[model samples]
Target: ADRPLLHGVSLRAAAGQTIAIVGQTGSGKSSLAQLVNRSYDASAGRVLVDGVDVRDWSLDALRSQIGKIEQDIFLFSRTIAENIAFGKPQAPRAEIEQAARDAQAHDFICEQKDGYDTVVGERGVTLSGGQRQRIALARAFLSNPRILILDDATSAIDSATEDDIQRALRRVQRGRTTILITHRLAQIRWADTIVVLDKGRVVAAGGHAELLRSSVHYRRIFSRFDAALPPAEPALAAA
Candidate 1:
């Protein structure tokens, strides 16, 4: 049974702005991201990039212009340098190192047995979840795409690691559009605009404070996140 994943969901993002999509599980957040990079073509309506239809662009050209990192990161069984240079194979070593630094991955990578030359096991099995994510981020940063999509990319990471990654993401997001599909309150708070999805539809859209005031659905979701936060920190109330 093929049901519509998104229904009449209309939204827009300005260049260099961050847009966060927040929702409960099965809310179609990932589906929306997939459509942006053309991983899944929309069954109806259209996706536009730079005011142009995504379908009109060549697949390679379209994908090359977008850098996407999902929760399930996939890294090859190769040296750290090789993996980072996957998108730009001819990139100089200096450029690769710069990208690693930008991803907050350089320090750990340098500590590895052979530094950047260390060969990872199949699917990066030798690396921890957080390390693999940083490597994936470094790969995306090396690509230097105009648009970045992060689909819960930091969910598996601990708070400290996620903070480092978020800082790196802030630097990489400059002069580019960023879409964050996540339920983490911290990540959602970073967006210039937050879109709330429920059952494949946009239930609300606005800034964090504005939605907190007007949308009960959003407040309810935030309440759950609030309850999970440390008692010393007044989560959404302070936001």
Candidate 2:
């Protein structure tokens, strides 16, 4: 059967709000993301940005405003600075450095023999997985997209490094809309709204406590964090 990948699915995020999406491996999370940036068009329905459907926008005009940090980070055989500045090719040195610092990549970048000028191997093979992700994050920070998509962006970083990056994520996420897909309870805890998907549909959506109390689907997906969440608000729990 050629059923739609996503049906009756809708998500809305106020400008500068963070929306976290969580589901099992094939719950259409990434499909929903691809639609937003038009990596592939939806077979039906629409993805809107600023009340305008994405298909109505030009690729360059649309994509320049979106930043993405995925689990698989790709880099060319170029200087570290060039890779970070890939999107904004003419980014000033100071801005690039600041972005790197925010991504917690600056110290390691400076430690290289050529510092920012170090030429990484093809696809950043010279860098460790965590380093690659931080560099990808630095690129996103430098681009300063109005809509940021972080799909398992911190998976490669260690717990301690992740803590630093999490603080940075909290700080930099201000003033932009963020679409997050991650399993880390730490990052998911702070989202303005959490949308829970199941079998390609949105099964539930709400704050951590609300979902913990109300959504069986969400609870199963995030049961490990149940003890850590604050109890649901009395009124919300009663709903």
Candidate 3:
């Protein structure tokens, strides 16, 4: 069955700004992200990019400038270098290596017996979650997207590998507009603006600090996140 998940949802991110969308599991966070690159078109209103309606842009043209990373990274049974260069097959080895380095994947890739020449199992079965994410990041870097979308991209990995992915993300995010959907407080706090959704509608939109002070929904979500962390993990805020 199909249903509309969002109602009159309106928001904007300035060029090079990072906007995070946060909400409960069914609050339409991912659905809203799906509209960005036009995975599904709005039934009514328009989605604009660079002042042009996304519907007006060719899919290939529109998608080429947008990169996305999700919780489950997909990779083919190809050489490591080939996987990283998937978006830009003509990319030279040096550029591929540079992208991997920027993604914090170079050293680890080198550790493989055949290094960049190693062929990963289907869907990257041979790689760790963090490794696959880093490879995805390397692919994104090579593609050089003008806009990047990350949907809980770090939520599944261990904290240690998460640190590496986060570092690579910071490097890759420069000079691009980023739409982030994450539960991690670390990722949420870095956004230029955080939009809180409740039951498919935006309940609040503001800086993290501002929302914490004024939006009950935001505070509730934050507290829930805080409570879910391990005992040793620092609270997102005081009780």
Best by lDDT: 3
lDDT, model 3, position 112: 99
Model 1 CA RMSD to the hidden true structure, in angstroms: 4.0
Candidate ordering by lDDT (highest first): 3, 1, 2
lDDT of each: 0.88, 0.87, 0.90
Which residue pairs does candidate 2 place in steric collision?
none
Residue-level lDDT of model 3, residues 59-169, one tens digit each, is 999999999999999899999999999999999999999999999999999999899999999999999988999999999999999999999888757777888888899
TM-score of each: 0.92, 0.92, 0.93
Residue 142 Cα positional deviation in candidate 3, in Å, after optimal superposition: 0.8
Question: Which runs of model 1 end up more than 4 angstroms from their true locations?
Answer: 228-239
Per-residue accuracy of model 2 over 7-117 as CA lDDT, tens digit each: 799889999999999987889888888888899998888889999999999999899999988888999999999999999999999999999998889999999999999
lDDT of 1 by residue, 10-127 (tens): 9999998999998888989999999998987987899999999999999999999999888888888999999999889999999999999999999999999999999999988999
Q: What is the number of residue pairs that collide in model 3?
A: 0
